[model samples]
Target chain A: MKWQIISSDQALYFHSWDNECVVYNSLSGDTHLLNLTASQILLKLQQSPTEAITLAKLVPPTDQSESHAEHELQIEHLLAELNALNLIEKCQSTINYNPPSCR
Target chain B: MNISTLTLSELGHRLKKAGMFLQTGTFITHLKTSIPSVAEGIRLLYADYPLVEHLDFADFHVSLTYPRNLRRWLKPQIQFLFDGKPPFKPLPADQAFPMLEWGLNWCVSSHANHYLIIHAAVIEKGGYAAVLPAPPGSGKSTLCAALVNRGWRLLSDELALIHIGDGRIVPLPRPISLKNQSIDIIQSYEPDAVISRKISDTMKGTVAHMKPPANSIIRANETAHAGWVIFPKYQSSVPAQLKKLSRSRAFIRIADNAFNYSLLGIKGFETLTGLVDASQCYDFTYSSLENAIETFSALEPPASSK
Candidate 1:
């Protein structure tokens, strides 16, 4: 319902639609559609103060009943991949999402 | 006259009236049109540049002739004049005349004696030239037309004449050719801009020519240092963005886009390489002309003493 916009030299808006996660560059008309787990991790990071731990906590729960643990692992896995892609930064175990500015 | 003789005779007659010679290797078409609009188009397109001098006689004369097409279609034994110089193989009579005429004009007059001719739109500001080279439908012409009207000097909107000796961009200052929607787009965007009458039903689709900036026309022979080699793509609703391109990659891309690079061989390669080394390259995409103008005006060329 709430659209969280993260702005720096460039701005990236994060939103969820039909449970799909979407990341879009507001300036260049470039859009990236993310999977449910990845989007959730990014969304959780928007508010999470403890970047690494919060990402670990946002993973999908291990079981339908153990939803919390499953969610935590899913979030950690997605964060690791996004971090590898250089789309996010981990500062002293805290992760930050940054987008490109003009060239 | 035989068909071969007819081609020569027709070319000679038209060149005489046009007050320009049909070089031995060149081919030209002679068109007699009563349309004042067509004559206006010629003046708008070629009036300023010394290389594109217009004849005072008729309303206008259009010539189409080429060399490579001749060599491909005819054997080496055939003789033809190129630039009024030596004898070269002639192109087949069946080939398209308009393209050849345009191509020969490109090959002979352009300062790129060593490099292949690039079909591009170039504009100058701040002592450097912005080379806008793109495929059809890429809006290069639209951006060029807009810039020329906005006080940037028009280097060229169709051919970039890169000087082979010094690696500088030789100013052509020719008319800007607008196709399809760009004609109206430019007119509406720049109401004060002077544009020629639109000629419809041409092979390249509905086309119009925009007058070169007065300053550009006056200093047609002045050259600018290579500044930016920008490849532009226009898309609706997209904001302007310039992406840096690698020099090696840019060289290959530009060479691929050139019309006569291979014809000039090693000279072409060296000229393009020198240009790439001296200039910055980018991939620019934008839908709004306003945003494009702002982005270009703000661009800071790399800091280096010339």
Candidate 2:
């Protein structure tokens, strides 16, 4: 999975691990972990206005046959939790949801 | 006597309407603002608070103007315009533009009577406050922003006001300001955080304000006894570490960060010395908020026998 560098300078790189649905910042010599689900939803949202499958595509399947429905439901629950945390912002327009400004 | 006495709802309406209100124990200010957007912004920021009239310390009233000229020359006018009895120093004639309003509030109203203010971040749990005093570019704001987003109650993100007399911390609980990368770091960490519009092209790069946590606002007037004074420096890759600092060394370090230490003369020294006697001092170097938070959470009061 590729990690996107959202913010970085000479000493620190804040990146999102799309595969793990986590955000981490590497600085000086330490790596800090951010909320997992929030990181995932944000990356998914960044890709496009993803529905359930779009998120599941980023993660591995628990079971071949049930992966589709299970992942969809999980994404729904994840989105709710993220919303409560103010991580995945809501948008009025159907087209896109621009993330809030950095810091 | 303090404006904080007002309920959040009252403060919201008065600031939006550009009305006059009381503050602190003295001084009166009348605000006059025409910008509807700025009006709404102020309203939302003071949401649920009573009008500024509730402040007890000052009797001053201010009227703010919208699209308001945020010029540097207005500092002195603002200082004089919000004057009180028995005479106060006139506002300095020269200053910088789009100057931070709440930052000034922390300097003037903090409970500390002796020490000058240090631009820094503070978070307290169990009465101990970690004071992150860093010059700009030290990643202090970024680390402070992340910690407060998690669970720490923000004492402040820009000003650490230490009381000189008893060494207690005066709670100013103002909004947190983030610039450039920090803004993004916070959004990634906690999406729901309420942030203000970005004001661009400033000397410190782009800037925006984070609404202080709701609970902090309610307790803004509450003061905390200084427990541990931890000066944090955030370097990206280092493991979290805390080192004890001698009281004499702490005094020197704190004085370097102070805003008006020289102005207060002996009172400032006495106030700082008293604070040192009451608190434990340390230097916290870290790249991990988790370790930092855990270390802070596990701190035993200096009085605890171990």
lDDT of candidates 1 onward, in order: 0.61, 0.56
Which 10 residues in a row give candidate 1 chain B its minimum summed lDDT? Answer: B21-30
Off by over 4 Å in 2: A1-103, B1-30, B53-116, B304-306
Fraction of true A-B contacts recovered by candidate 2: 0.00
Candidate 1 lDDT over B1-306, as tens digits, reads 112223334434534355342211112323332223333344344444333224344222333334344454454221223334323334333322323334444444443345346878888888888888889899998998888777788877777778778877776555567788899999999997777666565557776667666677667667888888999999999899999876656776787678766566556666776777778889999999999999999878756616
DockQ versus reference, model 1 = 0.01
* Candidate 1 positional error at B274, Å: 1.0
Off by over 4 Å in 1: A1-103, B1-38, B43-112
DockQ of each: 0.01, 0.01
Q: What is the model-wide C-alpha lDDT for candidate 2?
A: 0.56
Among these predicted structures, which one has the highest DockQ?
A: 1
Task: Give lDDT: candidate 2, residue B46.
Answer: 40
